[model samples]
Structure formats: C-alpha cells, structure tokens
Target: MGHAPVMTWTVRRAGPGDVGELARINCESWQHSARGVVPDVLLDRMLPESYLNGWRRWVRLPDPDGVFVAEDEAGRLGSYCTVAEARDDDDIHADLRTGELIGVHADPLHMGTGAGRAVHDAALDHLAEQGFRYAVLWVLKDDWTTRSFYAHHGWRHDGATKDHAAGDQRVPVVRYGRFLNARKRNRPPSGFRFPAFG
Candidate 1:
C-alpha cells in the first residue's frame, strides 16, 4: 500500500481578493467552535454574507494592522488570523506597545493540519516586526481546547474578563497576553515566507 502525500501550507497576507473566503472560514469556524457556548439563535443568524460585508470593508480601508492566511498545497484557505494595535478600552496593557490578536480561525476539517499554527506563528512574528512589545487575545472562558492551545503557544490569562452579548445571555471571555518577542524573534521557518504588504 502506498502512503498518502503530506499536505503543506503557505502563509500570506490577506488581500481584498480573499474577503469572501476569509468570511466563509470565519462563519464556519464560529459555527463549529461556538455550537453550545453561543446562543443558537445568534449562531443561526450568522450568515457568510454579513461577515463578507465586514471583511470587504476592512480590506478596502487602510488598516495599520494585518490579516494573514494559510492555504494548502491545493490552494484552499485553511486558516486565517488578524493582528492590530490594541484598541480595546478594557485592555490593561494599553499603555504598553501592545498588539491585539483580533481573530484566528481554522477550518474545522483543517484543525489538526497545522494551519492554525502556521497563521498564529506568522501573526506573532508580524506583530513583533511591527515593534509591538506585547500581544493580547480573547477566548471563550469555557473553551478548554482553544485555551490550552494558546497556553501551549506561550499565552497566559491575565485575570481579565469581558461579556459578549448573545441574545439574552452575556457570554464571558478571558483575556490572554504575552510578550511579542517571548519566543525567538527570528524569521519564519523554512518553506514559509511572510507576504509583503504596503
């Protein structure tokens, strides 16, 4: 029996042309990850079209931040992440040169394929390159899997919490942060290249 060929991923900066795919991935990932935590009504109402419009606007605007994506050898978008200057009023480290990891989602089917890691690593590297001294991200309080994932990647909860309204319920989220250069501040690994953005 012949073994299947392993798939590799390419990481790049997301552009306007990728809005549709990015929105699709975002919507689907939310559906998969928020099934029980988020209210059913809210999840059901989340259409790709709505997200597409938001992504379109973001891509059209001038953002000092960056959106990065990971694609498989077959040219399918497997995951995406976004990083930007911390703009949250609740951020405790607002005084520091901090960046916020706004979002990072992987296709449910691609969860274990390193797509998430590829985009996450690139996002951190990009933030460091942008001269951010620290980084922060929010995750569902009860989402153990994702929490552990971020923890393993060197993030730690800083005892911060926020409530996100979903229907009649206010879902709690925890904040995680780390030094942007906590890990090595070198170039990305071999075979992966950061995209050039204006």
Candidate 2:
C-alpha cells in the first residue's frame, strides 16, 4: 500500500557542467520555435558545437550576479535564465532597460511543463529582490507564439520597437514590460539573495 514519491526540481546557480545541456536546450528551442521569426542563417550558425563553446564562454563571463539553471530529480538541467540590471552593457537588445529580463531559454521538450515559467519567475524574483522597479524585453512583432508566451505571463504591452538582429537581417521588435511592486517582490531562495526594495 505504499506509493512512489514525487520528483521535485530545483532552480539554482548554473555550474560549468551544465553547459552542454543548456546549449542543447537553447539550440533546440530556438531552432524549432523561432523558424519564421529569426533568420535561417542565424539558426544555421547556432550549431551544436558553437553553442557549447558559446555557453562555456558565457559561464566565464564576469557575471558574478547573474545566470541560473533549473535541475530536475535526475540532477539534469532543464532550463536556464540570465538576468541583468544594466541591459545597455549587452548588445543583445537595443533598448536596454535598466531593469530588464535579459534572456530566458528552455528546452523545447520542456516547453509546457512550466520550466520556462519557473526560469522567468526566478529571474524576476531575483531582480525585484535586487530592488529593480521595472523590467523590459524585446519580442519579435511577427512572432505571435513568443509574444503570446510573454503576454500570458502578465507582461504589459509597451507599444515600442527596437532594431533586432536576426543573423544579418535587422527587424523591428515590439517592447513589453512589467512594473515590480518594489514593495512586495518575490523572495529569493535562501543563502544567495538580493537586498529587498521598497
């Protein structure tokens, strides 16, 4: 009359070992979902090995306070996120809102399993804990699925645009944002935490 236990996943700082899995998720998710949104050339360039190397370099970047990964019961990474306060410092996006949800990527197979949402929640929770009052990110105007994905999570339309690079192609992107309460932000996980804001 015994039952099997439930398998719980944990979200924590990403380590060097997660690079391979993270790259695979990044490559597969982008390649499969962003077909018409991103340029074909860019997809071609996101080669598996290239992505692995890229992640290796990324994990070494001077990000003493960014990047996180989610691991399931098997201790395998399922998704990851990169949160930054100074978006301008990075060339990935144009606007570079002071408080921004820099980047979030999830495994294609884990799309609807809440891994993406968990990654995003962790980022925002971290930022809000860091005292950020607002956050922004650019989404392709023509990428309805991606847009809906953001909207479904409560991002308000900002009615803005920015030049996005899809390989060599430049396209205008729509902006969306969310205003953190600044008074009651989500709490970060224990040990590693950011100062609370009001």
Candidate 3:
C-alpha cells in the first residue's frame, strides 16, 4: 500500500469564529491522547460541546493573538495553543517575568501532519514577542509522549509538580519551562565590588 501523503498547515491567530473548530480539535485530542491514561468515564465527558464556552473566552479576548490555530490546506483546523501571563501564583519562576502555555492540542488525525508543532512554535514565538523572558506549561506526569515532545523543544522539568483536577479525580502533573529570549549577562567592570563588601 502507498504511504499517506504529507500534509502542510498554516498557523494563525484564532478568532471568535474559530472557536467551534478549536473546541472540536481540543476534544478530539483529549479523547485520543488520554484514552488509557484518563478514566473512560471522564474521557467520555470530553465532548466538543463541553469545551465551547471555555474556547470562546480564549478566542474572544480583546487581543486574541495569544491563541493560535493551525489549519490544513483543506481548511480544517487541526491544532491550537493558548498562551498568556502565568496564572498560578506557585509558578516555578514566580519572581521572574514569565508566560504560560495554557494548552496545546492536535487532532489525532493530524498527528504527523505538522499541525501540532506549527501551533506550538507560534505560541512560543508570541510569548517571546510579548516580552516574556521565560515560559512554562504543565503536563501530565505519566504522559511520556507529550513530555518528550516538550523536551525536544527545549523545555525542562524545573522540578515543580502539582495535581490537576480531572473531573472528580486528580492526576499528578509536572511543570516544564524554557527561556524564551535568554541573553548573556554583562559583567561589571574588572573589579566591581558589592556594597556589603565595599
């Protein structure tokens, strides 16, 4: 049998009109990726309709450019990611300027079509452009596939962990972080002294 044709996708800022498609992609991704990991009862509730309101808030923001969607040439939305200021007070880099990659999901059907990575890259770029010096995201601890994906993209565990509320149950999750725009620090003159030492 012949191999499946390669697919290309374009990444763009999501708008109010794209909320429906984004919801569908989100549900489909959760259903497909969380099959064995999440309880079937809980996964069954991951319906597209259940995500509409939440997606609407993201896409309808005054500046929705922080939310990105990837569309295939066939005009189908296959993936999306939302990025914004870090929300959790316990974020690893609490004292530093940081951004959060709220979520990133790709339709199972578009797994190998670059849809996921396209939106992923777009989110990071947007965060950097918004002047975030660091970025963070949470992922299920047992989700090796996703952990690998983020690691491959320069994210590190940062040794932070938390429990995510999935329906009535809680799953252990870990935080990943990366520097969005790191620069070398300039050293003081040859013999600069600290105020305490001086």
Q: Highest TM-score among the candidates is held by which one?
A: 3
Better of 2 and 3 by TM-score: 3
- Residue 134 lDDT, candidate 3, scale 0-100: 72
**Model 3 regions more than 4 Å off:** 1-6, 63-65, 92-95, 182-198
What is the total number of backbone clashes in candidate 1?
Answer: 0
Candidate 1 per-residue lDDT, tens place, 1-198, comes to 443333588999888889989988998898888888888788888788888878877666445588899998788999999888887756636344678898789888787778888999998898888888677899989878788878878887878789977667899999887776555543333554331111
Provide the global lDDT of candidate 2 against the true structure.
0.68
TM-score of model 1 (CA atoms): 0.85
Error of 2 at 183 (Å): 10
lDDT of 3 by residue, 64-98 (tens): 14889898878788888989888776663644467
Ranking by TM-score: 3, 1, 2
lDDT (Cα atoms) of all candidates against the true structure: 0.79, 0.68, 0.77
Q: Model 3: how far is 84 from its true place, Å? A: 0.8
Pitting candidate 1 against candidate 2, the one with the higher lDDT is 1
12-97 per-residue lDDT for model 2 (tens digits)? 87767888887888888778778887787787678666678777877766532467887787887767887776555432223222
Sort by lDDT, top down from the best: 1, 3, 2
